[model samples]
Target: MKKIPETMKALVAYGPGEYKLVTDFPTPDCGPDDIIIKTEGCGICAGDLKCQLGAARFWGDDIQPAYVEPPFIPGHEFLGTVVDKGENVTEYEIGDRLTADQIVPCGECEYCRTGRYWLCEPHNVFGFKNFLNGGMAEYVRYPKTAVLHRVPKGMPLLDALLVEPYGCSKHAVDRAEITNEDFVVISGAGSLGLGMIAYARMKNPAKLVALDILPERLEKAAEFGADVVMNPKGTDVAQKVLEMTGGYGCDVYIEATGHPSSVLQGLKMIRKQGRFIEFSVFAGETSADWSIIGDGKELELRGSQLSPYCFPFVIEHIMNGDLKTAGVVSKTFPLDEWEAAFDCATGKYGDFKIAITF
Candidate 1:
């Protein structure tokens, strides 16, 4: 086996929207139960973008930039090959393909014991709040549990980079009980929303309504099997969705915009006794008029944090070609152009998922 480098390159964030490519950082050490992955592909997630700015809440306000220091890597969705493993790392060998979930939970936590580890308190997501060198770097180390599962055989590593977000979308759809005949509306054509669009197609919904402010994103949404794409900027989304669903509203609504107004729109677009699953994490409080759901409308509102037993399900779908994982990605960038990748991922240039290839 070849010797590993002592230092490697990575995209470091000092504060909101601030980042620089650094190549001299020390490679993180691998523990007895840990593995070091040589990243092949990384997906710039919305949450990671938000984390670049002070708006991100993954780490409490107390651990702001001043506390974390510079040279902090911020990538969570990624796929790679194992290059080195500690003595006890038996599940993976050198050159094995793998993808990792961002969150690492304490097995002793109440949420972990209850099988809701994704929502465990003090949950530290790699590249986000608690500060772990994430996949944006040339290499990252983590425990076996954080390494969700092996990549599908014969699947491209680039497509595998998408599994993380797709898992999150699956949880939302599954929690809402989406079905073949259900009319589903997804608010936000961002990467997360696009993942929802792709996975929702597997269920063959009666109609899929995609809402976004950008035409470019909506255009892509159509390609991903969205039945009708609506730009809510100048349209009455609630009325349009209602009319599209025969005045009954949609059976399921997934809010991925992380905007309070979008959440309200989701609440209004659900049919009485329907389900609204919030896929976005809107930090801070915003007023929500409960009167719409208070009058015995029998609405079910859910807050889906991340995938819970949905990772393997998404992997199977992608492997079987039931879900269009590759279609969801619109562009790719070399790891050196981390700034450009981050910008494109945040919809600064346009709408579409931006992937980083090493």
Candidate 2:
């Protein structure tokens, strides 16, 4: 274990397109049931990039307050070493490798009582609000209420940072309920979608399809295990999917494109009574024909939120080599090169999952 610092550098997000690199931020205090973690690495999630682009959905309008209360550290997907633990804690030891789910629920809510705490009315997500500040800092305190996972000690930080994203994918896949005979189509090849590709393939779907506007991402999707990858920029993706499904449409469709057009596009590619999993955090509101969901096709539309009840599966899959994060985690940067890291992640250099290593 390393000596705890009194103050450390951290990146704070004040609002849309506004940030300050703070070098004198006080180290978080560990509560009786909390543990202090030295951040190893943190990845830039799609939602984080959307915030930098000034998306109204995350930043909010004059009528509504932003989901993220300004001035909080903003990296949600992270891994760390358990540097110190409080007296009440026995699950983690100093120098242990670990990560936590992005949210902490009250546990007294009805949703938590039913084992669905992911949607608890008073739950706090790591990055969205200041009360539950995220992992972009050098050190963070993991409260006992957080859903924590003990990762293997020797796992690479790049791969460990992926657990959060893969856990989200697991929830989406659970909502989709794909089987060996179902034809599945995932409408995004970004990091989250790529993880979905790996998990969906493990389910042995009859036909696994990946669609994206970027040829590079589509190629990576194929490499990650999508049976087929398509670039929608110059093709009628819905028509192609329907034709591939013998004019019926795919049995399951998961939308992670983070684009407004993807919702309706997925609607056109899923068959009657098919399951639709929507997980992307869009920058703006998305509207679709309500009739298509019920009257038109009677599709099963499910909205999957944060990672819940899936961390173990993701950790195991990654550890056993069933799920790989080779090309997915594109690059790593030291904490000082924050802007360059964001630039690379936002496609300045190229679209890749960029992480900041401490």
Candidate 3:
């Protein structure tokens, strides 16, 4: 192994829309219980794009407090090889392939005490906080509190990059509690939405539908799992869903599109007692008729956060060829070309997952 460098290349976020690449950024130090990884690659996510564009949930507003602490690193969907380990770290060693959960829990919070660490009050997600810098750099440090998992030696880079998103997708599908008799609809055929379609298909729902504005993504959704695909540009999605289900609407609707209109569409296309699972991070607040959720229909609404205990399942499936990852990652860019990478991720050039290779 090469000697640890005093400085390394990194992308730091000083504020919303203010990320810069610095070649001389100081490399993170390893604590007694920490481990350092030489990053292989990191995937650019929609949430990262929203944060870059000044999402209220990330930058904060008069109504909600900010979740992000600027002057931080900002890539969470990542994987790498272990290059250094602290004195107290024993479960892993140098040269091991590894990844960690996006959020690091306090372990003493009320939520953590009950095994619901994803809801830890402080909510210190990697890439958003200064202490927990993310994997958009040449290296990353995993603290003692991180939930670490090892990647198989033979796993492909594309399949490895998808574990994080697919884990979240599995969690969202679990929140829906799909049954064999239910008719499910997932709005959005992006990477995360396509993962949801694959996981939902495992439930053997009566009918699985995917909705998207992009025909290409809809086609990928079909290849992944969706039995029916609909484009809202030329069709009234709500009426079409109603017509297909004898005017009762779909039994389950998962909102993966960050657009506000998808929320309204879900409310209109879900049945009276249907379940709705929301997993997207929006750039701003969304408004809707409260009556639609209460008086109009006693619908069940559930919001899913990060992947909690689903990483293991995702890794196992990916290694076993159960999850499809072909064509999911549309492009890859070197760290020096971060600007173009962001543009491609935000749909300037294409509509698929974009990754930054180390």
Q: Which residue ranges in model 1 land beyond 4 Å of their true spot?
A: 56-71, 129-131, 283-285
Best by TM-score: 3
Global Cα lDDT for candidate 1: 0.79
Pairs that clash in candidate 1: 16-52, 16-53
lDDT by residue (160-243, candidate 2, tens digit) is: 989999999888988898999999999988888989999988999999999988888988889989999988889899999999
lDDT of 3 at 83: 86
- Per-model TM-score on C-alpha atoms: 0.90, 0.96, 0.98
Better of 2 and 3 by TM-score: 3
For model 2, give the 10-residue run with minimal summed lDDT. 345-354
> Ten-residue segment with the worst summed lDDT in candidate 3?
346-355
Candidate 1 vs candidate 3: the TM-score winner is: 3
lDDT of 3 by residue, 51-141 (tens): 8888888988899888898799899999999888899988998999998889989899999999999999988988999889998999999
Clashes of 1: 2
Two-way TM-score contest, 1 vs 2, winner = 2
The true-versus-predicted C-alpha distance at residue 262 of model 1, in Å, is 1.5
What is the model-wide C-alpha lDDT for candidate 2?
A: 0.87
